[model samples]
Target: MVVEGAGPSCGLIDGFGRHVTYLRLSVTDRCDLRCVYCMSEDMSFRSRRDILTLEELTRLARLFIARGIDKLRITGGEPLVRPGILDLFAALSEPIADGSLRELTLTTNGTQLARFAEDLARAGVRRINVSLDTLDPERFRALTRGGSLARVMDGIAAARAAGLTVKLNVVALKDGTEHEIHDLIAFAHAREMALSLIETMPLGDVGVDRVDQYLPLDSLRRQIAGRWTLHDVPMRSGGPARYARVAETGGLIEFITPHTHNFCADCNRVRVTASGTLHTCLGQDDATDLKAHLRTSATDDVIVRLIDQALGRKPKGHDFILRRGASPQLARHMSETGG
Candidate 1:
């Protein structure tokens, strides 16, 4: 039954006293490319009937906004690849107009941004995060399993021309990508865009050894400090990344060290998959089947109660360990979890 007058609460506070305000909601679990760190090759995607519809995703977004979620980031294997995705963006932008949502952003692979950047800007999306691990055309192609670097570059340019702020998300790889870090930083700074280096996490068996791919951000930071001065900044982007200012380039750089330095002590975000599974902790397996409640004729109060229960089960922190010949910490791929 549809229950009326179920007003919003103060906010979603977890058992650890962290007020949750940011949500990473996935629109689809399918991507255009097969990144080695994100998923395995020849993978199977969810059937259309298994995923949430645009209307249902929109309703869930509004419910989260009413419950004090200020920042919403739409993610996916590749969100733009989903058909009718612009409709979802337009629908979610409604909360931004009324000030219920502080930001409406997305993290995309940038293959389709050239086609939708203008529409996205018109729909109230102010900023976007584009994943670009390498700048070399051949390396980029190999890294993304045949993705076109030129396409990504064009999409980024189109996004900039459309007046949307862009941030580059790079996955730091130990396999000789360290030498390109300075170049990547220069590229981002030259384009007036912020860049963040992320350490590879053992989320799934991508057919590659985790130990070989793991590049600790702590060591990488020291290496970066040798060439350029990195001054720690107090700025936060409502996520796990720690900010720093590169004195040489006068640009912003960030490090996301899930293993080297855990940010779970002040965790204030939650993630929901395209299938409606609410994961309170990224590394943990505990999840609430939000689709079960969403598909039923459950009222707002019922949904809220389910969310509260899930938050109560949030663990203290994640235990991520990387060793030789070890399996992934979680069986579910990062793609499935809304990377």
Candidate 2:
């Protein structure tokens, strides 16, 4: 049911005047591959009882759409790894058919894309972001802790064949995978796919030193500009990625610099974990227990009130820093929060 006082004019406008229109809802924190940067080798995932059921997730999506969320991205440790995830995608597509939701997308590790790409496309997913750090088989396996590079590559091809617009998400690691940046860009551009290079954020203890892994995008951009003719483009893909057109490959490249550059001023997104924890800020621990409210059989009005209260507490920006011996800003990993 649509909230009575919710719409474009009276939607979720935070204190900083940033209107929230995007929701990144994580279906599960369980991933097939344990990437070195995202999670520890022996990660402990959330229990099944704690996660929101398919029915609950569908209801939450409806509530968010009623409150003027036009774009919804299904995220997770790996969204595709979540069982019955396609059903959720199919259910969320209802809003799209009714003109209430503008887009439905997801970010995946591409491990399962080869098997589910067609189903996802049929369920109204037009685009997807695949996390691929390196093209070399050995390096890819090392980064993903035994993930098959060939399998991911096949998944990308399958996604393309299934008529999904694929974007490669590359996490820039200092002294790690930097050597393959050019090849990755070439590979993505050749397939008419956009490549996003992200600076690794200190989110969880993956047994690796973040200080040694951190690579600022500002410096990387300069290095990239030296080789390719880059012209800044005023394009945004709903998240914090800033885009630029590479004149050499006639393709697009995105710089997701969370540390060196703060893209929070225009932040229009909120994340909900698999367990239904609503996070207003990625770097802040100020969150509302939405699952508690949901499990209590609260009325829609009461839930809406809780959501409004959370929005009122949204901070102006996040406090993400990268330094030697500096602990993670938040104990929850990006996987736990929603990738």
Candidate 3:
């Protein structure tokens, strides 16, 4: 019982009336590095049939754009690990060139970016955010298990050179390497890259023993001790973050805290997983299986209806961490959920 274009331009609308115009697409469930925080030693992956093909993704994205989805972030276990990524980017970028999409970006582990940064830039990728949990070489090696710190650093430089707005993402952990926080901020300032410190979410396959390491953002902010000015910057056109800025050194730094910040107040994003399920909230367990719905009813009207129904279920805020004792109930790992 979905209408084609009834809801406010955007494909979905939550009860709060926020136009969900942003979509995160997962192209693959494969990643090269086994980040200890993301996957465990005994982790296994989804079957090939569980992933959506590039063609299917392009079609779904086109549908989303038609419904006012102007921003897209191509995510994955690591998007670059998939073959013909440039080709996929080409297919996904057409809307951006024609003005159907306002922005196109990607988040990666940066291990494979050195090989494709320029190509991705040429393919209409305007921004790139890379996950770098720690700056120490040995810690990086231990955390990622099989990634080279030097290679990731080189990739960041290459992305900047290619005219891509490079963002450095770090997951602030209590036990691992909190001492490197200032050093990382300094590094990003020197390189003129926007940096983000994320609180560790509990949805990944990583062992739950380190749940205590999930440092609440307020403590991290206090640890910085007014080294830089934190402006009340509003969320801009791009879907990077809602609040931020680092005045002293020039580059911006955002504290991404799904558990601490709870941006759901102004949330405008809906995630479409690689398996074709639509999630209203990133931390919520509720989801609608769009693939099954599409198979039986491929009409745009029906799809929009399904999206609306999902959005209606979107929570006002994520209290899972606070209520569930810092552990998310959904068992799906981060890679599988397109984080």
Candidate 4:
């Protein structure tokens, strides 16, 4: 499927016969919360000088769009905490409004969403994924180390009011989560938001052993099936998640099973960190530093060549179980990689 002379096909085809179409662009590594499972409270933050500018991100995104990327998910260490970020959203929307891009979305902690949900919708973002682990305020505070669950609730409501389709992501853990899972599904149903259960992966040195929290997808799905029938929902995007519909509440559920690599067969995304590094795989240490290559002097063809090389080497499956070490292989925190 390659062009007559170019290294790869014009459709952004990878060597594995998968077309990469989704880009998860990180705006900043700085976060507003210190979640125990995501980041350590004493974690050192990167200086603003090392982060990518909004202009650089937008430029790189346009090149990706031309390379067959149709969806962009602006992620971060709570991207809303990044100053002047609404401007980036407005900038990315130009492609969407003009039909060059199919979708533009974001993932946030929802702590600051109450401030910009409507503004973001007006800026051309129609979907958002808010990270919510628990429903109880006390437990939420304990997990996030002082984050206000009330603020997240208000933010979800505000996004809905602004006509944005909202999805809630819950980090599933092995122990003491039976009741919380039920409550989370109920909460999503009440708000008409889809909920996705993400298995806690061994991503960073979050100061806790992941084996203690690594909840299996089967166990969680079995728990949900005990209450409501889950009918499968097929989405066009060949992303990592597989969705299901909850018949009783008319809600949707997505399972992010990196642990089992259930969705790896059709994985179709690459992530760009805030520091302008291209990560072809989320759980792998492989990365291509694109900051220098993406300078003003670099042509679009040059950028595409670099991207083709990266996508060609994209790992087919995440190394979740085959790891030979006790510590996390990926030293960067999830915040630094945009979750």
Candidate 5:
């Protein structure tokens, strides 16, 4: 079932002409944690039939990799919650190891990583991104409803012990968990891992509908009164992001200011949801039903055309933070967006 024309044949000349290399794949829309920032208490999950089978996922990955997607990221409501996740990793990473793909990574809530991190690393997951909003136990319990801070902490240790390139993702909210910024930085520095403080995007079901608490990351950066210099890590040669290391005598930190600094200029990625839709941008809700297409026209040429069209439709970049009217694609819940 190796589709022919899908062999790295389709790409476009963007305004700057960068070939898209990264692809984020959502394996399941079901997550175990009902984080206050994502879904509500009674939010329903996507039907089981909607999720791509492991074979279907591997086939999709193969087709995309054949189309010049060099880097792959596995995301979900909580990627690990999906059954056969490690097997999925094995399935996806084997192609990369065999030279059909270049990189493979996973994003998880860290609650489930403690038991599986070592196995994931062994299965060829080179990098890991763990989501942790607050360090305070009670506050964490509040932020991610029913999540235990201790469990997440153990997961982090397990991930580090497994030799994965770990990165901590923190969503900075104004009055809620902004107080944990310094603590997060200290933790990352102590463990020699990258800590990225993300600006809260207004994209969630009930959690973000109450998005009034979104923090301006620039203000967060400026509030660090202590003199610390940042050294730019060039991403222009590039894969996923434009990152910098914050340096000050004894320690350093990595900050990903995606909102303040629009990496979209050099953005070389697209996302496919768990149900098999191709999304050009998380902020712009333009997506094509790749799953339906796969069921009908599994031909490589047809798939390539759809991917090229989707890439061409990618918005210039998202300016929702600056604009007031409202954005159509910007309001979907993060759970649905797989990030």
Candidate 6:
């Protein structure tokens, strides 16, 4: 089902000329931990009936692969929590096993990775990003509300032990303590893994005043630049994060600054929620509901056309900017957005 072209429009090119080749698929919105930055303590999740079936998920992913999406990422409230997720993994891995999809990756909280790491490695998942904002047990519990830092640490160790290319993700808030930031850098250096520092996006309740929490990553970058001689790494993935290696530690750090840097101009990825809604840009609310189309008599070609219709009109970029009293928000939260 290749789109029958070798140009920008061959896959998922927008009017702005950015060739989209990455897909982030949210398998479910049910998370075991209520991270303070991601959701409210009493948040409600979608019912099981609303989620896409395993077959539906596979069909949608296959169509995207045909359209030239070489890299596919699995995300969720915490992707490992979904039952029958291994089946879905096996189904999605078929193309990769045969050399159709270039890479299949995942992003998770790491709380569940300890048990799933071996299975994930065996299922053809080669790379993963684990979210850990702090290393202190009390701080971890405070941020995630009952999440065990030890469990997440165990998960991290298991992921590495299973031979997975593990990367750590951290949300650097404006009010973060210097000790935690430095310690996290040290931790990554110890493991010899890349650490991606992400600035908080004003999405969902996350149970905090996002404006108060928002931090410009430039300062953090300067702070690290002062300590270590950093070397720039070339960008191969269309994802927005910028990379550099610490000359002293051989540890890498990628900064994904959506509000501060706004990579939307050159963004080359789109997202699909667990229930089959497609969002062309993370900073914009523009989305098309594809569940109805998939559940009906719609053909793959028709689905492809609908995707074209959505990407063709992709917004120039997200409009929300951080400022005093700014209350930037989206209709859907991080849970639904698949992070």
Task: Give the root-mean-square deviation of each candidate in angstroms.
Answer: 1.5, 1.3, 2.9, 3.1, 2.6, 2.2
lDDT of each: 0.89, 0.88, 0.78, 0.84, 0.75, 0.85
How much is 57 displaced in model 5, in angstroms?
A: 0.9
lDDT by residue (tens digit), candidate 2, 127-222: 999999998899888888999999999999999999999999999998865687888888999999999999888898888788888888888888
Highest lDDT: give the candidate number: 1
Q: Can you rank all candidates by lDDT, best first?
A: 1, 2, 6, 4, 3, 5
lDDT score for residue 135 of model 5: 83
Clashing pairs in 3: none
RMSD of 6: 2.2
- Global Cα lDDT for candidate 1: 0.89
lDDT of 4 by residue, 12-60 (tens): 7677888888899999888888988788778898888788888888888
Q: What is the lDDT of candidate 2?
A: 0.88
TM-score of structure candidate 5: 0.90
Better of 2 and 5 by TM-score: 2
Give per-residue lDDT, candidate 3, residue 213: 62
The TM-score measured for candidate 1 stands at 0.97
Residue 31, candidate 5: Cα error in Å is 1.2
Q: Model 5 over residues 1-339: C-alpha lDDT tens digits?
A: 576755566543344576778888998877878877677677777898888888778878888887778788899989898888888888876887787677898889998999998888887887888888888999888887777999999999999888998888887777865577777777777788777777766564463443465676778776653545666665453432445666652444444555666657677778888888888777776878888777777566777677777777788776545333343226566777787
Specify the poorest-scoring 10-residue window by lDDT in model 4: 1-10
Candidate 3: which stretches are off by over 4 Å?
1-11, 229-242, 295-299, 322-328
Question: Looking at model 5, how many pairs of residues clash?
Answer: 3
Off by over 4 Å in 2: 2-9
The residue pairs in collision within model 1 are: none
lDDT (C-alpha) at residue 78 in model 1 = 95
